[model samples]
Structures are given as C-alpha cells and as structure tokens.
Target: MGDELRADQFRTEAASPRGFRQVYVREGVGGVPLLLVHGWPETKRIWWRNIAPLAAAGFEVIAPDLRGFGDSDVGPDGFHDVPSHARDLYALVRGHLGHERVVAVGGDLGGPVIQDLSLRFPGFVERMVLFNSPLPYDRERMAGLRTRPPREASDYFVPQGTDADALAAELATPEMRRRYIATFYTSRFWAHPGAFAPEEVDFMTEPFGDGAKLRASFGAYESTFSEAARSEPTAMACPNPTPTLVLFGPSDHVIYPDFDRMAAAVFPEHTGPFRLRDCGHFVQWEAAHALNSAVTAWCGDLLAGRRRQ
Candidate 1:
C-alpha cells in the first residue's frame, strides 16, 4: 500500500524532441537510472502497476508515452518508425532524463527500440529487461529454428505492416478504432483468456482512438526489416555487449515460443528466458507481481556486482 500511496507522487515532465507534448512521469530519487518504454496499442499507463515496485527498488523511473500514442503528440503522416523512435528515445533519456547510461526495460515493440539503442548507441544502455518481444533471428538462430508445426500466421500483421492507407481509413472513426483495438484484448489467439476487465480494456485502447495515432503505431511493424538491418553491420563487427534478462510467457500466442534461444546467443551477456506461467502477451499486466519481483531481483544483483553483467 505504501507503493500505491507514492504511485501518484511521480513528477511529470515533457520534451519537444521526443515528438510528444504528452506528460511523462519520473519517480524515485537516486539509484540506477531506468527508462521504461511502452509498446503499441497501449500507453505509459501500462507501467502503472510496476512503477512503485521498480522505483522503490532504488532507481529513477522515467516512463513516457511513445510518439503517436496516449497523450503524446501525433505528428505528421509517415514519421513514426522504429529507427526514428530510437532517436526520440535517445533524446528523452539524455536530454530529458540527463542520463548517458541507463538500464532500459521494454516489452512488445519497446523491446526492439531498446535493442536498437544498445546496438546503435552503445555504452548508453548498461542492461536490458525484455519480455515476450521480437528479437533478431540471425544465422544460427534461424538455422536452428524449430518450426512449431502449425505456424499460425497473423491475419493482422501484413495488413497493418504493408497497407497502411486502407486499414487506417477502415477504422478511421474513434468508435471503429476502439472496436478494432478491442480484438487484441479479447482475442483468444492473443491475450490470456479473461486478461482484461471491461474498464481495463477501455484504458488500453484509449490512445489508439485517434486515426493518426493508430496509423503511426503500425509503422513499427512496417519498419522491422529495414531497421533491423541498420544494426547488422554493428552486430557482426561487434558482439552484442549488453546484458539482457529475458522474461517469457508461454501463454503468449503470437511471439515464437523459443525466442529465448535466439536471444541467448544474440545478447552475449544474457540470463534466463524465465518462462512465466498463467500470463499472455502483456506479461507485466497479467503477472505484475512476478514481473516486478524478477526485475527488482535482477537489478539488485546487477548493482551488487553479483551478476557481472
């Protein structure tokens, strides 16, 4: 209850370069600097449940709405993409948070952005905590890819990934947009069953109600191939030096099951692909207590030099 009491104690701030005029929250006074990034179809509010535990663990927690989502400014057309998001995030951490090196935590699309930070802006991210996210599958990982029999494809990705115009117009209205975003919260193929209460569903989908926000969010998927390539030259020349803690949810339907396998080799200093039970895509939401515990423990161990990563 103490944590909850201090939950609203976060000091709110904003930065122009991040492309959002939205209010952002920063908590905790002193410790390791931590930046928490949220993924698509959701906002920084998703971090509400973890804020207290994480910030209480002795770290300045900076959580912000990604551009084009939540209360953030939705800029002009075709501007939101993965590489571009990384740029804004860099500014937010260095310019806003005043941290050159930080512990970055992310899930969903946020993971990719953090990954880019580590790759592009090396020495800036000391550690990473990623969950149920897409990781780069290089040669060995791809070769060893054990095709999970019935490769269930998403009817969603390509439409959003490739054809932006048609789908954007289709769900242009707020009501229609919310209706479409609702599917992810309810879809059996996605979230864990009974994962969302009615109010929670509305909260998660609220940001995507705007057409510009909804459309910009899709660019993440679209920029996947091109952006990942930006890091290949670096990856080959220099091994991934960032230590990563990968928390995985077996209940998640979309992400490949054995991604931790790919991640293990990819991130030279890596820990458990800690399999989480009774959770789905939104691991932090469905398993908040467990996620909080794991993150804090890792942070503690990391700071104590017990982990050496």
Candidate 2:
C-alpha cells in the first residue's frame, strides 16, 4: 500500500500568485478532480498510500504540500493560516488547474483548510470527505460532545502556538528538527501503535529536516494565538453547506474524541460520521484501503453524475 505513489508519475508543481510555487502530486486524468489536502507535520507524501488507489478507483487525485511544509515554497509574506492555505489551493485547483468543481478530502490541519475552501468557494468544492480533523464547535448542537484530547496528548500545542520562534531556535539542526517531528509519528501515539515502521517514520519526517520549513510548519499553531494569523470573523461564523462524508479513526490519541459529532453539527448536508477501528489520526496512511473504499462508495452518485455531464 505504501508503494502506491510514484514521484516520477504524479509529482508536479503549480505557481501561485501568492508569491510562492506549490508542489503537488497529480494522478489519474480525465476523471473527477479529487483534491487531497494534507495537515501539519506532514506533506503531500502523507497521501502516498491513498493516491493511486483513489485514482484507480476512477478519480483524478490531487495532493499538494501546504505552503512551507514540503517542496512548496513558504509564503513570502509569512502567513500560513488556514485561510491562506485555502486561498493557495483555490488558485491551484480552480484558477490554475481549471477545475471549477472538486471533491476535497482532508484531515488534521488540512481538515480546517478544506472547510474554509468549501465555505469560501462553495460552488468549487462540490463535496467533501473529512476525518480526524477539527470542526467548528457549536455550544448548543455539540453540547453532548464533551470529549477533548487528553492533556498529555496535547502538551506540544502551547509551545508550538506561543513559542514557535523559541522552539524553532531550540531545534536548530536538521537532525534535531527531524527527531522532534518523528515523535508525532512514533512516541506521540498520533497513529495507531505499530502502524508505521522505522523506514516509514523516516519517510514522513524527512521534509522537516529543513529548519525553515519546519518552523514555517508551525504557522498553523502560531495562528491559534496570533490575531493577525487567525481566520476572519465571517469565516468562523458561517456553516459549511457542502455535501460531506465524515469518518473517524477511533485509535487516534491526538485529536478530540468526539470529532464525529462536531463534524456532523458543522456540515448541514452530511453523510456518515462512520468510525473505522484500528485506524488513527493519519487515516490516509493508516487506513488507506478503507479510506479509498469509503470515498469511492460515498461519492458513487456524484461520480456517475459527472460522467453523464
């Protein structure tokens, strides 16, 4: 399953007007455009296991490294918040690739990004598949969803949000940075235990060895505490109306336990908050076959509709 994506076959880059070049993997052709957005501490490589399977399942799988996370260039202006990430994607998929409609799939930080994309450009994102990602918290509708990530599970958030510069400085060397990022895949228990082998961990953390990219990857966390990097008031208040299919990986230790409930509350037109056992936060990597099956099955009618068009 890990051998699904070949760099030579799908790797490509698109220039963004936002003053940076974005690197991505473009697989399959002449099929429905399915955009795969990756999250923090990861790059487009996170979807390596899912891309080919999804493409073969009859969709064009487009996975890009969010700005500054991998081969993509960081924003010259230094903003890496969810809105900025969403805009970059819009320019790449809609403006550049000429896809006016697409199925957006994401988890982790990528989850909020796809959410923003759907809300900001509803017509463009025709449908969505969200898993193990954060969703808007509605106090009334989500009153029964009280589970939060355990304190030990989230101990890294504060320093990453408030002291990025200091933390970046502390992780001065490439080796140090990779070591730090490796924890998220291994000791951090973000994935189901034993999901990743040593070589797999190396492949996932390699991009973080670049100190600059590693620091820039912290932009999402920094945005949590920085007013300038936060999403706009209107964006935060609006509910996402895109037809969505939500999935949960119960073994995840880093994300909120009640992610399904929150996602159900936020997406007005939504499908299953289906839970996958033995999977964790990194669903694409840990549950590749299941993810592919769910996406292909859920979007069957939409895919058929596109074929008719």
Candidate 3:
C-alpha cells in the first residue's frame, strides 16, 4: 500500500445535473484521463491499490463510488441500474469534469456501466480495460463459451434481484448487512482465497454499514429481473466498437467461468482477454502490480504523450 491514494485526501463531491452528488477521487494533473469504476460490494477503495501506480504511469485517474454506494448520494429518483449509473458518469466526466474523452476501466457491475457508456455516448470513451465484468449474451458469437454464471455461485442473484425489499428488511441492522456483504469478500470466493486480511475486510465493509445505501445498491440487480426497475440506458448495444483490453482473474467463482472468451466474442475490438494467475474477481487488489503494469502497458501511447511533453 505504498503511496496509495488516500480517500480522505483526494475525494471530492460534484453535483450531477442528473440529480445526485457524485463523490470521486480525481488524481494526476494533465495526462490522459481514465475512469476506474468499481462494482458491487466495492467502493472507490477497491482501486486504492492501483490508483497511485496508474497516476504515476501518467494518467489522470477518476474513481467514483457509484450513486448509493460509498459516500455518494442515492438521489431523489433512487435509480441504480446500469444506465442510470452510466448517465451519472457521463454527466460527471463530460459535463462536470469537462473531459471529452476517457479510457474507461471497470469490473463487476462497473463493466456494464462502461459498456453502456461507450455505446450510449459514442466517442466519449476512447478505450476500455474490462475485467471480472458481465458481458451481454449473444447466442451465435458465444456459442461455445460458458456465458452463464455458475449456478452454485449465483445463489445471491435471485434473492438480491427479486426480493430486494425483503432481503433488505431481513438484513435489518448495519452489522447484519456488513456480514452479508462480507461473504462476497470471503467465503463467497469473489476474490482469490487469502486476498483480503481481516483489517482489509473491515475497511471494505465499513461503507455497507449504512442501511439506506446498501439497499439502494441492490437496484442494479433488481433492474435485471424487472423492466419497470430499469433506467434509460438499460440495454447496451453489443459488439461495442470501442477498442478494449480484457483481463480475467479466473479464481472468481461468482462470474462466468469463461469470461475471457465471452468478453472477446462480445467486444470485437478487444485485446488480450488475458488471464492473471492467483487473481480473482477483485483484480486491482488481488493482482495490483500486474493490473497496474497491464494498464500502463496497454496505454503506452498515452503515457508516451506525457513523456514527449
């Protein structure tokens, strides 16, 4: 954790025209901007390990806690679906931050948001670095790929999506909610075993201690089961034209086992689909050095531009 970006020092809040206040970490000064989006059971803290390294490699890193997660507000409308998240980011980057183009990087739920961002607002995302994220199902292209998540690993989905209200009610207390989210970080095998120490787990679960935010975070899952719960940018136009670099951490039991293959099929302009050993769902933390090296190498031209200056 040497030179890690401290959330307390850099976190800032920007009012989104779309109606929520976005809390994000904006680091680095004038290099090519890259947005590092986090997914379910995670906050911007997930990228803390990789942020300083990436900024050092010559890129401005913007990591935001999607609405309803971390310190960010859930907004009056209470929509946390992919499209809604994408729109919030669109407004944050293009509208508030004033960056016309960005290199989008995300995993888990962030995967869909970036995908939707690239599709819904073409030219906004110049490239993408995706890992441990969801890919749109295409029958023909993903013919041989294991596109569906393993059933044993997916027990949390139905409960979270369909019974969000009841589930939230059942969890009841902050400690109960944190315990539930803690499983994804531990026994759930969302990360490679032994990735998180006890203190690290405490840091990650601290934000979930808020009952309201935890409940709002379930909206994304709910959108999948009910159309009525969807936001405007609901469907992502696949075969996303944006050039992408796909990295997979195979140890993750929660997502599609053949994610690398499936991602390659869906993103025609994709590179690598590289698999990192001993890594799992949380690529940034599990394989920090590798993830940092990959991102810097993938965006060499951008880093070089800064060198040329």
Candidate 4:
C-alpha cells in the first residue's frame, strides 16, 4: 500500500543479549503465539494482509523486520545470514515473548531461517510452516540444478558495487520499478493479473528507492547466501516430532521444481505438502485468503489431534 497506509500497527521492542532493535506487531488476546517471518528484499509489512484476519480468528500474531531490514538495527556486522537471522528470531522469541516454544511460519529466505532455527533450538520450535524454500542445498543435487554457472564475486555483488547508484536511479522510474516487482510477482499471478494490487507494488518498492539503502540491503543477501552455502548444517534432531506443513506455489519460478524432492529427503517421515495452482513465488501475497484458510485449518486440526497422515 501507500507509505501512509499503515497495514498493521507495530510496537518497537528491545532485543536481548545485544539489545538490538526489533519491530513487533501483535494481534489477538489469546491462543498460541505465532511468529511470521518475511523473505528477502522484504519487511514484516509484507505480512500485513494476513495479520488482521488471523488475529480476528483468535490467534496471536507477531511479525518482525529481520535485522538490516526496515527500522531494525543492522546487526553488529551490518550483514544478514541464515544463522544470524535464526538467532535474532530466537532472541525475539525467548527474550521478548518469554516462550520456550512457539510456532514459526516462514516464506522464501525466511523458510531456510526457520529450518535452521528449528534445527539449532530443537526444544523451542513447536511447529513449522515452510513455504517455497528448498531443504538445505545438497551437493549432489546442486550439480543437477546448476543450469547457470556461478559468476565471479564481483559480478555476484552487483547490488553492492559503486554502480548501484545508477542502478537505483534507473529503478526509480515508474516503468522500471513496475517491471522489477512484476518480474518476481507476475509469474505467480499469471492466472490472476489483478491479484497484486497496485498498492502492493508501491509497498514493496518504496523501501528500496534510496540507492545506498537498497545496495546495503542487497549486499547483505549476497553475503549471507555465500556464507550459508559454506556453513555446516546443524545436526540437531527434529523438535519433538513437531507437526510440519509445507506449502508451495506450483508456478513459482525459484522453488517449485525442487521442493517435492527436497521435502521427501529432509522431512520424510512427517509433514503434509499443499501446492497452490497458478501461483508463483509470493504465495501469501498472491493468495492470502487461500493460504490463511489452509494454514489456520491445518493448525486447528493439529491442535485437535486430527492432522492428516
């Protein structure tokens, strides 16, 4: 929506350990706490459309801007990665919510962070809902998936280069800005072109209008992905056979092709997979009602011991 349209009201809170800044939006007065994590180049505001509905249905919701995103303080290193993001989320849960266990719902980059969090702190994660993120990249599969060769480090950080100033200027133009967002969302909304309202595009692009800000943000993604690729996978076991739900948009250009195989490999014994038709990467935004309904119903079933096998 427009800059003035406050999708959800948020309160700033101090994160423990390092006293890092965090923005949290909470709704509903009872029921289990649910944390919503957004993905790359996005902020907690992305979950705006879903918060009220869930809250109205008697669920408590908490969404935060991951480090270096939105108003949250960039981490001590001014970079973002899966481990650090997972830790930040942990701090938010344990320190702020004072909860030993809670459910986590994540999309895109957030998906991997949630996976890592559940792995690192097995006792803390109660349930997990992962969308459009593959399991940890496996070496054998990486070779088969490599349709394109890796670029040099310099090329890889194009958003961090000095030319980023010029790139931002070009992206500022209405036409280019629309194209940029459409490149990611259009494929998901192919069957429903009107799915992503114009305001949504504005909401997604407004934060990146500043060249330096955009560069720093993208730089973090580039750096983080590099580190996650090398970091050893956490060996912790699944937390209490927690009920897990996996969702995928069949048309998602980045994830659909590999999700089934990855899920079969990583969470072989537990979990149910739901694939949305004619939708792409941004499943929540593109199909909020359908997504929320499915997730809420699944949570209800799990709580009542009626979850599908």
TM-score top scorer: 3
For residues 1-309, what per-residue lDDT tens digits would candidate 1 score against the true structure?
Answer: 344323245567777865457457888746677888887667887787877788877777888887777767764434566566677788888876688788888888888778878887879888999887767656754576642412453668778877777999998699899989888778744678887877778777776788877887777766653453232222221246798898877677777767666667677788897887778778878888988888788888555552243
Please provide TM-scores, in order, for all candidate models, with all chains considered together.
0.86, 0.95, 0.96, 0.76
RMSD of 2: 1.8
Q: Which tens-of-lDDT digit does each residue in 3-92 have in candidate 2?
A: 543344466766765678888888887778999999988899888888888888789889988999889998778888898899889998
Candidate 3 lands at a TM-score of 0.96
Model 3 clashing residue pairs (backbone): none
lDDT of each: 0.73, 0.85, 0.88, 0.63
1 versus 2: better lDDT goes to: 2
Position 69, candidate 3: lDDT? 96
TM-score for candidate 1, residues paired by index:
0.86
RMSD of each: 4.2, 1.8, 1.7, 5.6
* Runs off by more than 4 Å, candidate 1: 1-11, 18-22, 147-153, 225-239, 301-309
The 10 consecutive residues of candidate 1 with the worst lDDT sum are 229-238
Clashes of each: 0, 0, 0, 1
